[model samples]
Target: MTQSRPPLNAPHSTAQSAPGALPGTPLRSPADVLGTGVAFPIGVNPRGQLSMVSGERAVTQAILSLLMTARGQRVMRPEYGCRIHELVFAPGDATTLGLASYYVDEALRAWEPRIEVEQVQAQLDGQDTSRIVVDIRYRLKGNPEPRSLVFPFYRSL
Candidate 1:
């Protein structure tokens, strides 16, 4: 004859809650809660001290970094950057300006998820041939107000 086993004291259903989590509450990842942050690059600020930013500010800095970096410059992620630098050598024309804007738009959409891009305008400076002005208009997530930034790139002739 076999002996009877004791009844289990565990909850009846594990599906009701996550492991180690309270009932009616679900677990969340860091990315889902805290926004992404990146340290300010060297020479970005004159303060000369390390600084980090989050939320809309972080997104803005990240956009500028991405735009400044040329594709293939980042190891192990050649496709992670935009080809904006190539615009420097390109003849300043409507088609070239449009292409630059397109590149910025594609790169932002692929990397930045915190903002909804409204418009990307790129144009060559009328007074300075070496300067290219790029204006990015976007609305940050969870924010109703729209924001914009103007990034100027100076190419060496």
Candidate 2:
């Protein structure tokens, strides 16, 4: 008898919207990355490790976008609410030390979310240098102390 309200994180299409020219309302597009004044040098390393200056930028942008969105903000309570427990990276080895730190600090700062990164450890799985993992511990609302969420956020990035 009553229609249920859509959750904050529900897809845009599912939300009630004004009528458009088409049969259905258009879906929202992905968030755009902010422009950074810095420029990156072009070229691959002799070790065969490819680097893209915007790699971390793009990732950080996405994370920020998600948090700022209506859905993300709902979950991201400012008063000791939901926070990132940890950020684990792959390639478990000697590489990715600086990269991991940069990503966690920069991205978390941009989002303005309360998350404590205990340490950035390089995990090496065999000879693969493409993957790196870092473990972090933080706290969210309804909990007195910090806990580890172990979010598998990095997927094929």
TM-score of 2: 0.30
Clash pairs of candidate 1?
none
Error of 1 at 106 (Å): 0.9
Q: Indicate which candidate wins on TM-score.
A: 1
Say which candidate scores most in lDDT. 1
lDDT of 2 by residue, 17-113 (tens): 4355333445332222222222233456566665443433444434444322332345454432122223233333343455554555454454534
Question: lDDT tens digits, residues 78-138, model 1?
Answer: 9988877777778878888898889889988887777789999998888997788989999
Q: How many backbone clashes does candidate 1 have?
A: 0
Q: What is the C-alpha RMSD of each candidate to the true structure, in Å?
A: 7.2, 16.5
CA deviation > 4 Å runs, candidate 1 = 1-36, 42-50
lDDT of 1: 0.77
Whole-model Cα lDDT of every candidate shown, in order: 0.77, 0.40
